[model samples]
Target: MDTILNLGLNDQTVQVLAEATGNERFALDCYRRFIQMYGDIVLNVEFNKFEDALERNKRRFRVEYDHELQPEHLKKIIDEYKEIIKSSTGSEFPQEPMEQLRKAVMAVFESWNNPRAQVYRRVNKIPDDLGTGVNIQTMVFGNTGDNSGTGVAFTRDPATGENVIFGEYLINAQGEDVVAGIRTPLPISKLQEEMPEAYDQFQKTCTLLEKHYRDLQDIEFTIEQGKLYLLQTRSGKRTAAAAVKIAVDMVKESLISKEEAILRVDPDQLNQVLHKRLDTKVKFNVLAKGLPASPGAASGYVVFDANEAERCGQNGDKVILVRMETTPDDIHGLVMAQGVLTSRGGMTSHAAVVARGMGKPCVCGCEALNIDYKAKKMTVGDSEIKQGDLITMDGGTGQVILGKVPVISPEMSEELQLLLQWSDEIRRLGVFTNADAPADAKRAREFGA
Candidate 1:
């Protein structure tokens, strides 16, 4: 889903918004976000150019995150952003609201055929002829102040299938900032201390949504001036292990029938639950360590860019996609890579979330390694790893190994075994398998063939 927030803001409306809200800082922040998004998505300006400008301002003001910048600092950023747009696009940031809206809508439609979208559709087996739709609505400001924020949440843990509210949020930030992994976000539990009213309302809303849908829900929410708003809700995406645990748990809770639970789990995703793990007995050199964003082990040649990852994969190479951080546009590379590594971003970063959804191994926030894309190398002190160097990563441990390490197959979780038993009991078709050897036959029998 492509989103462009603060759509109505222009030179005139910015001042109007500031006066109406009595918060010039919030208005200026909105304008800055609009330009960055508009310049990147609509006007085709490089997003990093805007990030570079923002980073300069952040350094100048000695602030770490975007929300820490003052109104005067934001004003400077806005001016510089406009100049960047003008210089890059050979035109000023469009001042006319209607024209901007039209172009924005068109951009969304055109994004249907973007590289990332195409890759996603191909990976998910979605038909290419299916197009995308555009939704236009009034923009609510989440960057208004400390009382406002945005977040993404799941009614149950997407990674673990634990029956807990799991998510992350950023105070005084737009929705994209949370998902884009540009800034690390705080856990949803922290919201209770930060904005108790909004947090309470959100919990109730999550409960209602889960009960009504009869499944775990993924929710997008925003708070403006301490008031809660539900942006949207759908069935949450979860790992294979989580899917089995949730379905079994729902059946136990009487929220769903055993048959329904069996239907809920995708047979293909079961492979993720049976994924390989690093051989604990093997000795290996640790190149770096990071946050264990997902659970599995994989080894592949290191590739720095998404496009290169895809090309290498197409040419029959196993690659680990390394990045400062991933965005929605990196779907192609994420799909292609055996695993993912990032020097920036946290556990709920876009790369981690997407990797877990795809049942891929991922290690995030590995700061010990410095990645130089232009140089096609990664460095740790004096040790250098060039592109195509063989590397192994254990997403369960967040360890990046110097070279390939052997992996052992994992046993099925108890929940997964129980789910499989239920599936066999309910399924009508008789299962059989062809075995060329005694070992094959024994294994097939063990699997209930």
Candidate 2:
């Protein structure tokens, strides 16, 4: 539903939708929704206008459910939505369906120049003129009924890198409901109890996806009236520790060659493995827990503003940057901070991706922490932490602790050493290095050079 609405559709997609649902009306409904959504998101038509129209129709029909509206009422909504668009833009909505499709395509092209897109491209070093690809796919309705649902899952635990499925899902809801934080979603495990057959099928699908892709997969799926449909799948992101463990395990499982395993782990991500870590055996006062977006540990004074974080960092004071959510504009502060904490955002959000790329410790989607930027403070339960107040965090466990906490330097694991050894054995080229000092030579010898 999201893809068709956002990207517009081609004949192929329409045909698939017709075939899947065996309802011509389903395709027509998709077109109607696409027009309204595209107009609101890309054509600058205020969404409230369309929303108000929908609410009015619901009331007039005496229907509490969106899907409960009669076909005629939905048709009325489409007409009303078009009128709203026409009035807001001082232009008539395209009467021809092909013209509407063309306009939507152009709007997607225009989005490349939008401020948010430009900032993301610049920050990520993506070429500005390369343009984004449009993928028009058949829609699957997760909000069909009690037997319908949507979810996102990882073949492995994203937080700890364990080779166990990790994800969240919402029943009788769209995909956006889970990611947008509109409501707290149930853990993926709950699905096993609620829908055992679907859960088993999903587990098999996960294994197949990972095996076919030759990597851990992040997958989105929808169950429509008890039928499972895979929406999308891609390689999953992980912290440096998790990356190392996964690569090593994959090699051991004979799923990939040692050379492939070695190549899989990013060299830059290794820096994250060297960061300080909280001792698991140590006791501390726990404030809250959230998604462990990046792995490491740090204790620092909190600062809400990015500019302030930069300023404090420049003065040699360790600081943790806190925000409701972060953008590419916060890059400077992210670079300066010892760690990062956010009240909102998931494992793949801007803050998480950036912090992991920079090898910084980060805890995101900490919903328990209510931040007030103007007040320069954040609260968890009855406790309030003001600006410049010291706190410690373990990005590996996603634990926020009050005040300073002792940490120890991370040591290279035996598994990592074995993986490197296997890599050396598999590669054609011999391992060699130039050592300028006795200390360097000693370290090289220790590494079995």
Candidate 3:
């Protein structure tokens, strides 16, 4: 999706903004961000060019983060970014508010059929004809200063279905900074320390939203100048285990009935609930360890890049995608891969979140593995593994194994069993077994056939 923040800011409006806000540094920061995002998303300028400039200015100023750069440093970045856009697109940056708005809207509409969107719809079986809609709202600055911030929160834990506010936030940042994984974000719990009033309000708002929606809600919000504003909210995506647990828990809490709970769990997702795990008796060569981002085990030939992963998967090869870290642009490859291993990024990074949502095994922040994307190789200690090498990874344990190993299917959790029972009680149709043997028939019956 294309999100152009701080739009309609030009040399003229920038001055007016600085005067109105009484903060030149904040105004310039917003202007620079606008140029970088607008130039990359709308004007087709290379995003790295802008990033490189920002990095250079940060180093020149001896600062660590983007928020630390002063107004003068940001001015330099804005000028360089504008030059990059002009050179890359053969035109100057759009100054007219209407022109900027028109291009941004067009870009968003064009994203409806983008490769990632198409792949997502295909993988999820969403109708292609449903299309997409755009929502335009007034801009609110989360990068205003220390008193402002942005965050993404789920009413319940999307991983375990626990009833708690689970989220991450970045003070003095825009919404993108939280999800982009450019900067490690603080846990949502830290919000109470930084801005108590906003945190309290957000907590109450989340409780009310969950009550009103009667489901786990993914909420986006910004606190500008110590005042909170909700940007968006939707049904939160979750892992298969979480889905089953949440449905059962909601029923027990009297928030939903047994029939509704049964219907809420996707029948196809039960396979993920009965996810496979590495055989405990098997002796395996452990290559490295990292954070267990999702729960499952997968063994496949490794692929170094997203494009290769997608191509290999389409050709009927089970592949594990290895990367330094994944981004939103990698959804197609992520969808195709059986599992993912990353050298960087935490549990809530793009790779981890997407993998969990798709019920794919994932290991993140495996810093011991030195990845060389150009050579399609990864090295750990003295061992080197090339592309297409067979490997197994246990996302439940965060262990990357050297070769394919035996796996054992896990029993369904209690919540899943209860959910199945509820479904069986409410289902009107009768099920018949196609099994040819007594044992097969018995197993089918055990599965409520």
Candidate 4:
């Protein structure tokens, strides 16, 4: 995995391939990109300078992230990018195809510690030390005009664990260009209407890749004048909902066994989605602001202290649980409150994790608020608010609105459940979903993951 590889043909080989491809521009563009990436890693080019130069070239061409490009526009963009590198660096973009291959190999290995790459590793729990092995086979361009395109597809739905191939694509675009979600992307389903032949090919390819990988594969591929080129493939992640549905369906398909199904799900994720949520559509009265330790919209009379919160709940008054932070003793109040709030704690802090597991709405770490339990009021920055007030918090986007805006319940359709069943059958692993609240857990259970 730590090995660097030099790839591609020499001048004579490039010339031979150019004749075969009948596109000098395409060959050269690939040659240059390989050099740019590789040179930065192996030759130690200053990245900031490289980016600045790249930006100037992009400005020079007036190219946008927009994908609606004709054949001419794409050729110009690539040609100009090469022109920029030459002009900015005072050298030709390396044309010795072997040089390009060499640089690409170095670049991929170097990507392991790239800033964003580091962050991705931390979040995904990938080890920081495992270097990547660069893979360089043949260059495949999707922007070769009418018959060309690129797309990303997952063998199973990542959101609801549906068994169908789920993904998106853009015609006349490179493989990575469409997945960035820069501009609005066309649905993968669009291919059926736009190019039925291509659509059929993609569908069949997805099935083959899934079976070959023996996992929920996320694939990157392109069609160069109607022929498919698979650029890369890896396992895909999914929402808790999708996890359950897919696990069950995959069982039906005999892809996984009963015990395997249970293990497929992340127990923690299931816990998070089960929190009680305030009906998003319900209206709320404006009152105090504080931390939401868990997530769920809540509308109730303010209870300044845990004892009061518990007492009010006993009296059958829906209560807004207010706290600077909750201690173990406050558990009863937290359970009774329509929602819990904390003035402290990070996402991994007690309140944050508990709230997620409970599937409760919480806005935590709101440092601006100071609770005055004795006075029955809280100070939020310059404002002071009293007990008996109402407010709402959204756990999903971390938005706390003055009043309720609109709410919609998410119910899994039968098709979704069936799809996940297929995913379970194929993976031969249990696909339990994350959920903490009744609604969220119900949603997951409905999917049968």
Best by TM-score: 1
> Which candidate would rank higher by lDDT, 1 or 3?
1
Clashing pairs counted in every model = 0, 0, 0, 63
Compared with the true structure, what per-residue lDDT tens digits does model 4 show for residues 1-449? 22222235444554565577786545544444444444455555543454455446556657654343333554554465455556666876665655665665666676666654664455456888776665556567775566778777777755445577776677766653453232334567877887788789778988887767656777777888888778778876554555666666676778787566667767666543333444645665433443333444555676778778878888898876766655444556666676666665433333443344344566665656687877898776576667887656665445555544455554554534454454566675666887878977876676674
Between prediction 1 and prediction 3, the one with superior TM-score is: 1
Model 2 Cα lDDT, one tens digit per residue, 1-449 = 11225244434564576577675444545545666677776677876587678878889999875546655776677778778878898887655556656766677667677765665566557998787766656667776566889888889976456899988887876675455443455779999999999999999999998889889888988998899999889887677777778888887788997788888778776667566889768888899998787889999999999889989999999999998778655777887899999887666566776686667889988999999888999999999999999999888788999999999876577767876787777768776779999977976675667
Using TM-score as the yardstick, the better of models 2 and 4 is 2
- Model 1, runs deviating above 4 Å: 433-443
Query: How do the candidates rank by TM-score, highest first?
Result: 1, 3, 2, 4
In angstroms, the error of model 3 at 294 is 2.4
Off by over 4 Å in 2: 1-40, 44-100, 113-130, 279-284, 300-338, 344-358, 373-376, 386-390, 403-406, 423-449
Better of 3 and 4 by lDDT: 3
TM-score of each predicted structure versus truth: 0.93, 0.71, 0.90, 0.55
Clashing pairs for predicted structure model 1, backbone only:
none
User: Per-residue alpha-carbon lDDT of model 3 for 147-220, expressed as tens digits?
Assistant: 99988888988777888898888889888776666666678999999899999999999999988999999898
RMSD of 2: 6.7
Residue pairs in clash, model 3 = none
